[model samples]
Target: MSARVTMKDIAAELGVSINTVHKALTGKAGVSESVRAKVNDKAEEMGYHRNTSASSLRRKDINLVFCLPCASREGAYFYRYLWEGCNRFEQEVIDQGISIERVEFVVGGYADALEHIDERLQVGEKIDGLLAYVPGDDRATHLLEQIAEAGVAIELVDGDRPHFDRLGASLADYSTAGSLMAEQAANLVHASGADARVLLLAGDPYTDSHYLTARAFHNYLRDHNVPWQVEDLTGAHAQVKQLERELKARLSSSEAPELICSVFAVGSELVADTLVSANKAGEVMVIGNDLFPESALALRRGIFTNIVYKDPVGLAYRGAKTLGDYLLWGKTPADPVQKGAVEMVFASNVDRYCKLAGI
Candidate 1:
C-alpha cells in the first residue's frame, strides 16, 4: 500500500502546496478547477477518501446553508428575483460535494425562520457557514447570532448591519445611492419650475438601509435649499389598501408635495400606482428604489424621474461566494463589507437598463 498517502504526499506528487490540496478536497474557492481536479485525482489514486463522519473527521467538508426571506402573494416577485440570484450562485459550486440547503420563511416571519433553523439542525446537517437575507428585526438578528454561536460564518445579503455584530455582509451602498438619488431629485425639482416639495416615503424606521437612504435624501434636500416632508409607510408596504389610502390622503393635503421619493421597492410600486391612477403622474416628479415591473413601466413613461436599481443577483452571488471562501479555504473576503453596484435609470435609459437587467 502507498504508505497511507497524506496531504504532504499528495502535494509533493502534484507539486503544489498542502493548502491547495486541502482546498480542493473541501471544494473551497481560491484554487482553480483544473488544480482541484489534479489534486482530487491523486488523492483518489492513493486510496484516500474524504471523512464526513460528524466526529473527529480528519478531512473537513464545507456545508453552506441559506435562509432567504420568502414574501406573501404581492411581494413574491421581489423575493423571486432575489432567489434567482441565490440559485445562480448555488449552481456554480453544487458539484463539489459541499451540501447547500436553503430554508425559507414568510415575508415577515422571523419566528418561522428560527423554528425552521431548529428543525434543520435536528436532522444532523451541520452548518459551516450561512448566507441569509436579513430582515429588519432585532429578534431575527438574535436568532442569526444563535445559529452561528458554534463558530459558523454568517454572510448577510441584500441588507447588512455590522453594528449588530454580524461576521460579514454584502449589499449595495444605500447611503451613497441615496445621495445620488437626492441630486437627481433636486435636478427634477428645479427643472419643474414649481414650488415642489419632496414628499419622502420611507419604510419601517428599523429598516436600516431604507432609513439611511431617507436620511441622506432629507439631508441633501436641506443642503440644496429644497423643502421636504416625511411620511412613515413602514408597515404599510405590503398593505395595498393602506398604502393607497395614505398616499391619497397625503396627495390631497392643503400643500401637497409635488416631488415624491419612495425609499423602498414596495413603496415605489405603490407610489407609482397612485400617481398613474390619479392622472398626476406627469405632474409629480417621482424618485424611488427598485426596477420592478411597475416601476420600470412608470420610468419608461417618464412618470418616475429616476429609478435606482440595486443588483439583487450580485448580492446573492457574492454573499454565497464569500461564505464559500471563508468556510472552504479559511480565507476571509478581502472586503468583508461588499456592496453591489447601483444603476440609475431614467426614461431616456430605461430600455437599456431593462434589457441589461432582464426585467
Candidate 2:
C-alpha cells in the first residue's frame, strides 16, 4: 500500500513551512487565502488525510465577534434585521463549539468601535473571527490591519474593503440594483411615449453601496442612450425633515422631475409623501430601494413605481455563516466577495413580499 501523505511532505512540495501547511489545513488564522488554497489543493493531490482523532483532541472553542451598528441608532432600521440574522446564525451553531459575541456602536461611530476592539486585541484577547461592517476611513483601516495582524479572521458585511486581507464579504450587488432601477425607469418613460426629467436622491456619498448605486444608475442611463435629464442630489437622506423639505421644494418647483429614483429607503418614503402632499402623485413615477412596511404601503397605493430590495437579512446571515464556517471547518468561501440576491418589486408583486416580510 502507498504510504500515507503528511503535512511535512505537502509543505516540502509547496515550498512552504510546515507551520503554514498546518495553519491552512486546520483552518487557523495567519495564512493568506491564496496560500491556503494552494496548500489545500496540494494536500488533496498528495492523498493527505487529517488524523481526525488527533485533530478532535486539539480543537478548541471558537469565539466570533459581531461588530455592527446598534439597532436603536438613527437611520438604523435595517440594522435591526442584520442583528436578527446574526442571532439566527448563532443559535444554529450554539452546540458546535462556536460562540458569538455581539458588539454594537451608534451609526457613524465605527471608528470608536473598532478602536475598542483593537485595544482588546492589544491586550491578548483570543478572538478567532470577526463579522463587521467596516467603514472607509484611514483610522478604521489602520485598526483593521492591527486586528488582522493579531490573527483574527474578518468577514465584512454590507460592504467590502478589497484592499484589506479579509476572508470574504457578503453584500448586495448595489451596481446591479441601481441598473435595474434605471432600466425600469427607462421602460416607464418609454411607455409614456415622451422624454422625462429624472431626479436621483442618494444617501451618504462616502458609503460604498450608495456611491456604487448612484454611479451605476447614471452610467446605465448614459450607456443605454436613455434621453432623460438626470439630476443627482447627494447626502439628501441624512434627516427625515431635511429630506421632506428638499422633496417638497422639488415637487413645488415648476420644473419638477417627471421621475424620481431614491436609492435610500427613507428617501423613497419621503419622496412619495411629498409628492402626495403636492398633489403630484399621479404626475410623477417613483422608484425606490428596499422593502419595508412604509415602502410596501406606498407600492400598494401606487405611489411607488418599483423598489429594488437589497435583502439585508440575507446579507448578514451569509456574512456570519461564512465567518463561522471558516473558523470551524477550515473552509474558504467560494468567492472573495459574496453578493446577495437583489429583487425588483412592483405593485403587482408587492403583496407577496409583504407577506414574506410579515408586513
Candidate 3:
C-alpha cells in the first residue's frame, strides 16, 4: 500500500522538526529560505498531498470570491457591462501578480458552481477576500457578517448596509445621481418653455439603488415648481398600456408633459416608445436611467436628452481591486467612502461611457 504523506514524513526526510515543516508549508513568516526550500523539495519528492483545506483555516490563499444574485440565461444588459469590467480588471491585476478566481452565487437557486453556501466553501478554494453584489439589504448584510467573522476580507459594491467596514466601491451615492437626472429633465422641460408637462416613469422600487433617484425626482419637482407626476409601473404591460391610454387622453383634453424621466430601464423603454409613436418625440423632452443600446440610438435621434448613467463595470473593477489591496497588503481605505459618483451622459458622449462593470 502507498503511504500517506504527512508533515512528519517531510520533516524526517529533511532532518528538520515538524514545527519547521508546518511553518514552511503554511507560508507563515519566520522560516528561513534555506529551510523552506529544503522542506518544499522533500515534500514534492514524496508526492505529498498537502491538506490545503486544513491549512487554509490558518492561512488564506490569494483568491477573490465574487457573489452575485441569480439571473436568467438572457440576463440583464447592466450585468453584461459589469461582467466585462470585472474580467478586464481581473486580468490587469493578475498581470500584477495577484492570483484571482471568481465564484458566483445565486440568491436562492444553485446550479453547478454553487449549490448552496456550503458549496461556496467547499470548491477547492481559500478566499483571501470577497466581492459581493447582493441586491437585497437583509440578505447581503447577513452574508457579509459571516464572511467578515471568518477573517476573510470583504468589499461591498452596489449594495448598502452598515455591517461591512469596507466598501469595494459604493452604493449610497445614488441620491446625487437621482438629483442630476431630475435637473436634466427639468432643463429639458424649461427648454420646451412649460408648453409641456413632465411625466416621471419609474419601476421596481426595490432594485438598483432606485429609491434615492425616485426621492430626488420628487424633491426637484417641488423645488422648481414644475408640474409633474411620478408613476410606478412594475412591468405589467397591460396596466402600462392602460396608463398610457389615459395619459394620451389627458394630452388630447389639455397639453402634454414637456418631459418624461424614466427612472428605471424596463419602464423607460416602454414609456419612451409609446410617446414616440404618438408623434410626441420632437415635442417632449425624454431622459431616463441606465443606458442600453436602444436608448443610445434614441439619444442619437434626439428622442432622449440625457441618461442618468451608473457604471456597473467601474463598481466591480474597483471593488475587486480594493478588496485585493486590503487582504494582501493589509491597507485600509478612506473611512466612510462617500457613495460612488454618477455620470450624466448626453448625445455627445453617451456612446463612450455606456458599458458598465460587473463580476
Q: Pick the candidate with the highest TM-score.
A: 2
What would the TM-score be for candidate 2 when compared with the true structure? 0.83
Count of clashes, each model: 1, 0, 10
Q: Write the per-residue lDDT of candidate 1 for residues 151-222, one digit (tens) a residue.
A: 456888877766544557988888777888888877876777867666777765677667888778777767
Q: Report the Cα lDDT for residue 74, model 2.
A: 42
Provide the overall lDDT of each model, using Cα atoms, as 2-decimal numbers.
0.73, 0.81, 0.62
Residue ranges of candidate 3 with Cα displaced over 4 Å: 1-60, 69-75, 96-99, 103-115, 122-125, 164-169, 224-227, 232-256, 276-280, 336-338, 354-359
All-Cα superposition RMSD per candidate: 8.8, 5.9, 9.9
Error of 2 at 185 (Å): 0.4
lDDT of 3: 0.62
Superposed model 2: Cα runs more than 4 Å off: 1-60, 73-76, 236-241, 355-359
True-structure Cα RMSD, model 3: 9.9
Model 3, 111-142: lDDT tens digits are 33323443455453455566666435455455
Give the 10-residue window scoring lowest on summed lDDT in candidate 3. Answer: 106-115
